[model samples]
Target: MSDINNWVLPEGIEELLPDEALRLEKIRRDLIDLFASWGYQFVIPPLIEFLDSLLAGTNSELALQTFKLTDQISGKTLGIRADMTPQIARMAAHHIKKCDAPVRLSYLGTVLHARGAQIEKSRSPIQLGAELYGSQHIKSDVEIIQLMLEVLAVSAIQHVHLDLGHVGVYRGLAQQAGLTTSQEGELLDVLQRKSSDEVVELLETYKLDKKWVNVFVQLLQLNGDVTVLEQAKKVLKLGDASVQQAIEELQEIAALLQQSYPSLPLYFDLAELRCYRYQTGVVFAAFVPGFGSEIARGGRYDNLMIEQGEQVRSATGFSADLKVLTRLMAVILDEQAKEIILAPDVLDENLQGLIRELRTAGKTVIMQLPDSSKQPNHTALIAKVNDKWSVS
Candidate 1:
């Protein structure tokens, strides 16, 4: 209604100034190149799609975050993407020709969320990620995690703390205990919050055998260093074969990561069910010392393709907010130091040639207008010296 209101952007939405924009672009290009080196082909999915396709294979959390509208042309409900992972899955399943080998794809773009996460309050974030499809092996999971760490390294972020979990662990336990879907969902909620009293109360209400009760309780304390995995194997021995298999998969991946990144901090959390409804297997998130929440996260969603009505395929990937990465980058870009050449208003052919040469050599050149009173800030100036036009 007012001029001020017109300039005010929605909460959690932001615009980048010149310096920040330039730095973000540089980081984006560098990371894209990094993904390319790893044999990941880049993809550019649309910002909006039909609601059903956009929301396919994702959880209710994503659905709540998506902003919906009616498309006048098609008179169909459309949804702006709140997360690109599902779209990436769709592309891999339908667009790309089916191949036996895994399809590696990377994407970078802005995603709109109706509401922001509590820790990071940005509704509009530039999401950058890579996905490996068609492989169910632990090696693929490890590769995705390794690539996530490399992304942090490229952004100059250090001291990353990685938290790993397997949804299969809990899935197996619930199935073995014969808990109903509602009961499992309730338990998952309490476990994620580490609400000990509530967790105990719910398990007591379930009236399970002591072994089932004990294993469920132990899940809360199963978070710590790598040693927690050994404890999990022993405590969860009562679980079915699927439980043991999940633990073994985690162990194998942890061993590989420790061998490759010896100094990386790894924490095991059996109760960490991030993206639980969407993820089918191993889940992981990366955090730094000061950051209160994960800077990047992803997990295995082996059933996503099948749920989308396509052939079965395994998928794993991680996504980070490019805006956050730019903010946390250790190297500060000094845009002011960039050379800017100012050429005087002139009609001489030689002056034009020199301007062209400077521009061709990657210099920013500003030609002076005939009668303009405005003067731009420039780091250098083009002047005639000894009958020759030169930059000083």
Candidate 2:
């Protein structure tokens, strides 16, 4: 038999104590309020759902992270949601299928992952994000990015570095080069890790055009300030229209963000594909000083609704781990201060009436019991003074 005294929590699982839990709740509420102010409505998706529905469309990455189990009643596989984006996408597809363009939805929930995504990170994370459905316009992308920046700002995280990229650049090149799906996946893996020699070797193995291969090399090299955009335009001049259009969109969005937030530093990494599988177009991430990973990440995924058999809508959004943000902010959990009044044990009508008055006035009054030995820590004491009940 296992030793009962040797208590231990499962790895990657954690419990939040009172103060920490309260602080996290406060941050969650504040962020949701902020989302509401920006016209994003909140929705809570089920913590567990049908595996197929939960991991639908280009979500292999998410599927791997999800914890799956056979449902006792239905015998169907159910997965504890590893990512809430798909659930929100389904809702947008089925519930608001006929709604207007640009349906803004926000969600705050705990998503359970099979394993921690990073070292020292929780297996369960408080995911807070807003998604924009419909409208493929670049302005929509800009809006989501700006909202992400605002979220970080509201959390009191500063010195943010925004790294921007467009997956379309690479995806377009692969399509134009006629690389098979297997080949493309391998190349993407190489590119993500930035293995330059491997990328060269893989491209050469397929005998792709040397010019396009050079463009791939440039893709790896195109990481720096806004000047890299000019470099990309110059080096990838022979890219397809899709690639060109992607570059133009990045240029416009970067320029707009620079003009809007002159102080916020922006870096362009043409090869920075955070969510290459599902994310189709412009992708971005926000990082603060001293944090090794991105504080928040999001990009355009317009095909999600269409893949779920809903009307075609262009969408883009970002999500951040609220727990990470709260920690990074160094939030000091504070208990709500209440004016607690300790009342006398005597049940005289006058004393009761005085207690009632205090209670009615939003004061917390603790009436003492005659036989009780317990005492309450309070801000004030109610006692009879000069034949009148008064607080001292």
Candidate 3:
């Protein structure tokens, strides 16, 4: 027997009802306005595009997560966007490539991934973010990080724990060790899983530079408070200039952020290269007390534009799922839901004028229909009292 609930949605797909949708929309507007205040122009990329354009220069893994179909008009493959960053990158490099100064762009839209990023996450997430292009200074990094902190503040996310890492620390060491791409990939995978034994096994199997191998092992233990930088310097004593420089960069960022947010909880994880493949430099993730997964994460990916055959420029940004934040808002917020004011179905000019005035003042006024049962719960009813209309 077929259990036919025709309205049932596919797994991981969802529809927002009136209250949830209203709250989500309000957050979106507030965030976009915040971005604008920071001088970031908003851009809307199409929901779908040609496959090549969609996945160009991104991690090969993204292809599997993308939904594909044959286009009838051009007989070419089209993809529903799994991520909007690539499209925004394309716009920055091609359509708006001529800007002399760094381009700061923000976006908010629905992205359909083939599967959820985590076990019970949404397949279609409202991706909200800002991207900065054309500057490589530590100032650029600090700006994006500060902006991200501000975003969390605006969303009312409390007790945020920030985890910071830099891929350049590992990349430079890998270069010095002369490890091949496959070897680097394997090591990155082991580090991401934080498996100490596997890392040792791989290091012994490769028999790479003794100094670099020791440093690699030390990375796993390098975590916690700003003091971790000092420990990193000692642990990576044999580290090359690039490694030293990466540490210094992290120190500067930490100092600036700490100075700004004295009470902010900050952690440093040297082996925290979760998105090592796509991220070229500094990477970060934000977590609250109860959430097992990161609420938001992003980092520097300067080479993305180069892959698209455009001049390489510095770029960094962060994105959070609006749906998740909305959930959090619901938990912490007690917003008073507005009620509709019932207006009688009278053709009197003064009654109609009064309803118009209330609506213009941002009140919700619903005209009572002929059927009383169809009327909404009346918070206030407009009645004809004497010659003027009054609320009863």
Candidate 4:
């Protein structure tokens, strides 16, 4: 006898039923249209690639989350993509190199992770995102942020709270303090946890100057509303020039976002170092009231393409799990499932023609089969009236 566990799926993997799949498809089409309206051409990268190319310039976190296997043909290690950013970066560098102007690209595909994120438990997520390449101006960053917010709005996800940060803040301080790579990593680990005690202990253990230690500790508290920017300007005034520049960049981006979305709840976190290993500049993520983790995130990675053996080009974008967005939308939006029509299984050319006509008119027509006891849920049915095919 076959084992009962044969049908069970791996943990964190999932399949969507008919209703959920329909909803997800509809949202996918709508989002792709939205991106197109913004001049973002859609692209589909491969699900797997050479491990080195797939993980190029990405942090160890991504490498840890990737599943690796040997390619029988080439005898080389290949990785199932855990993220699409690196893949897209390579595409921009190698494939779309002829054009010098900024390129806007969007993609929707499934990404498999070896381990799930802290709050999101799914290891297989349908990732949907847009990337803008070849520009590093503050306007480019603001545009990406605006587009991200627009994406959430289109998905009917409400009450979005955006948290903004710049890794340069911490990087600048780490450099000014002359902290070694190992020491910087240790400090970063504690800063991410917001453990002020550990941060002080580590700093004292390193014997850093009081000025650097004070600023480093102050980084942990530089969070909250817009006023935090003013505090940051004064507190980081004595640090590296890049620290001051990062603060200014954040200020400018915030002002633009406020102008475009005056009622948006925006927060700042100086100590936030998301994807710090590759992100060169500003970083941001969106959240909702009950969600314990960010729903979507992206940041500038000016050096990623260079690491791919191509010329340096600035890039920034945002991504979210399409499945998660669809789930959240289901809760917020009223049910408006499409109408499905049932038809008789009789072998009649006229009936077949009518079914075709109905389907052409955007109606879902499911023909019944002979000797079948299965019943389908349909909103309407096709019937014979006056010797003609009609929907009743």
Candidate 5:
């Protein structure tokens, strides 16, 4: 029972065995190469930082996700970065300050959040994403989406969907509802969970225009294939300039992506609000089979430049969640686990170098069987005996 409090893995935490760990590392490397080819250099923000600094402009919900503590030397509150987006923002506004416009940076690191994250999420999960600075053109939006799709395809992730959204759409709706900020937050909470009863109760709290209420409820339900957009266009009713503008953006971006990647699936969700506070515009999340959350997510943020003390310059980009991608690959590998094994059964210096050379050249060589009696974890699988070598 002493094991109960020895700082071991708590429930919902996962420890990757060698095979799974190796596979995850390989997937991370492949994604890095994918981003590198597109000219995205890498940057790794520190895992721990002064809590207030890391949360410069983030929302409360995000702030609560952090795991905090006090630094011994400074006695100031510190926390693990909940996400890399804000840190990347800091970097653009500071470290890479000298770079030219449209700076493209990618990163691969584990982000630590509160332990109460969604059941499947590891409090520590590897994130692979990018931040594109200094451009807000529609072409930039289209390119970021295109890059996300390309990474997924190159990662061998098929049978997926890219659901797009605009926080602008929701902001306009909430404003039209004439509800207080708290009321709007309630409204968003209901829609975020897709709870019709809760949404109806909250809608009743405000004497909202019945027409707008119906349209709002309908938008929450509006999620599906290309046909959903047709239904959305009907309820949207040409009233919300923001919503209409967002739709036009979607159409333009979708057209560009389809021109280049006709096979890529694309659609929209007007009520989808993942990172509501941090993203200033056009947001998209990619979901592949067998993964719970988005495999990739990013959006535009022009206002961030103003906050960064730089003149507002629209920017947009996306990142593939390496943790999710790794999990999906593990599921795929488990379904096809059979693999060839190899060994050079001599316990000598020269033989060891040969084995090392084989591995360095990308050969999967296992030194021994798992059940071997003499030094089960020994480097080589078997030893020379009578001028020959054998495994037990």
Candidate 6:
């Protein structure tokens, strides 16, 4: 007998069944092709990186999730990537050239990590996304958002909401609060989680002004309708060059995107904001039902090029968690039911030929079709053609 202990797979990891696997494969093909249609080039970055490279002042929450160990050859701390954005930024900075202007990239692959789940989720996830580098135009931001929606539209995920924010908004608010960096970070964490009480406590503890405090609390509750932008000025008074200017940025992006995705919902949350130090402009999180975490997330980072010492430019992008997308919406996926070509009484040559032809054409072809004779209720589309060939 096989030793069960030796054969057991690790917890939180899963095997994709044939049907599930095929569905995911189709999802990938569809999305990659969709991205290609928009001139976004395919890029499969290596899944591992020197730990220091990825953690270079990135979100501490993200750094904690990495599956870490020392590299055997380099003797350096190497780790599985928890996020791909930093590497994408690095790749753009290193190669891709100065004149490319807007370098568009797309990728679909597994990202391994430990403690992969966020506050409520408890499973490691497979993430897929695309990035737009260079070009700091607000149009680039709207374009990426439209593309994300298009992917969902094609995939038949109808109810999608993009909760957009300006990273600078809260970061600016943090500056105005006059709290130390550590206090600001803790307050940001509370806001991100939507814990209003924690946010209120922080505002009081920091002794922020009443008007600013009111705006801070309202920012946490910023959600629903583009009309919120119109009301923002009354609620949150701009502090000359700080948080107020950041609010203006979000409102500007909202107006630009609303013309295209007019029904697109907009929101503001001062509490749940972070200075993705690299993210210089608008940031966003995409939510869809069934997936416990953000389905897709990205933002504009105009400083990465300058950070690497280049002429200033801007870009924005997003990554859709293809694994979660396929799994959660399996029922709606066109490929949910396993389809088999129902051919019968055909010679082995013809069957093999058909299978090979379809397989080569990139269709997931099942060798054997369902047999109603053997099972009595098998449902499959049987090819209805006589052996004699006729010219039409």
* Highest-scoring model, lDDT: 1
lDDT (Cα, tens digit) per residue for candidate 4, span 1-392: 99998989888998898778877888899999999999999999999999988998888889999999999999999999999888888888875578888999999999999997754478999999998998879999899999999988888899998999999989988988899999888899899999888888889999888888888889899999989999999988877789899999999999999999999999999999857887889999999988778889988988887887777568898899998888887254333566889998899999999988888988888978787898678888899999988889
lDDT of 3 at 81: 94
lDDT of 3: 0.86
- Model 6, span 1-392: residue lDDT tens: 88888977566666778767877788788888999999988877788888877665466677777888988999999878877776776777765575565788877777766764654443456666777877666678888888887877666665677787777767766676676888766776777777667778877887788776766678777665666655655565654475567677677777787788777655554344554555777788777765566776777877655554445456578876666677666355445443444445546665566657756876554334345345222235335358532111
What stretches of model 5 exceed 4 Å from their correct place?
1-7, 176-179, 195-200, 238-240, 330-360, 364-392
Model 2: weakest 10-residue lDDT segment is 330-339
Q: Using Cα atoms with residue i matched to residue i, what is each candidate's TM-score against the true structure? A: 0.95, 0.89, 0.95, 0.95, 0.83, 0.80
Candidate 4 displacement at residue 48 in angstroms:
1.5
- lDDT tens per residue, model 5, 205-314: 78777776787778787776656666766778644687777767777777787789777687778788867766778889888766677888889876766565665356
Alpha carbon lDDT of residue 165, candidate 6?
71
Q: Write the per-residue lDDT of candidate 2 for residues 220-243, one digit (tens) a residue.
A: 999999888888887887778998
lDDT per residue for candidate 1 within 1-392, as digits (tens), equals 56776898888999999899998999999999999999999999999999998998777889999999999999999999999988998889874456778899999999999998873569999999999998888999999999999999999887888999999999999999999999999999989888877888888998988788878988889889888898899999999999999999999999999999999988999998967888999999999887778889989998888866667568899999999889888888888888888999989999999999999998999978888888688989999999999989
Query: Model 4: clashing residue pairs?
Result: none
List model 3 lDDT by residue over 33-122, tens digit each: 999999999999999999988999998789989999999999999999998998888888874467778899999999998987787899
What count of clashes does model 5 give?
4
Cα-based lDDT at residue 220, candidate 1: 89
Q: What's the lDDT for all of these models?
A: 0.90, 0.86, 0.86, 0.88, 0.73, 0.68
Candidate 4, residue 62: Cα displacement in angstroms equals: 1.7
For model 2, state the Cα shift of residue 16 in Å.
1.1
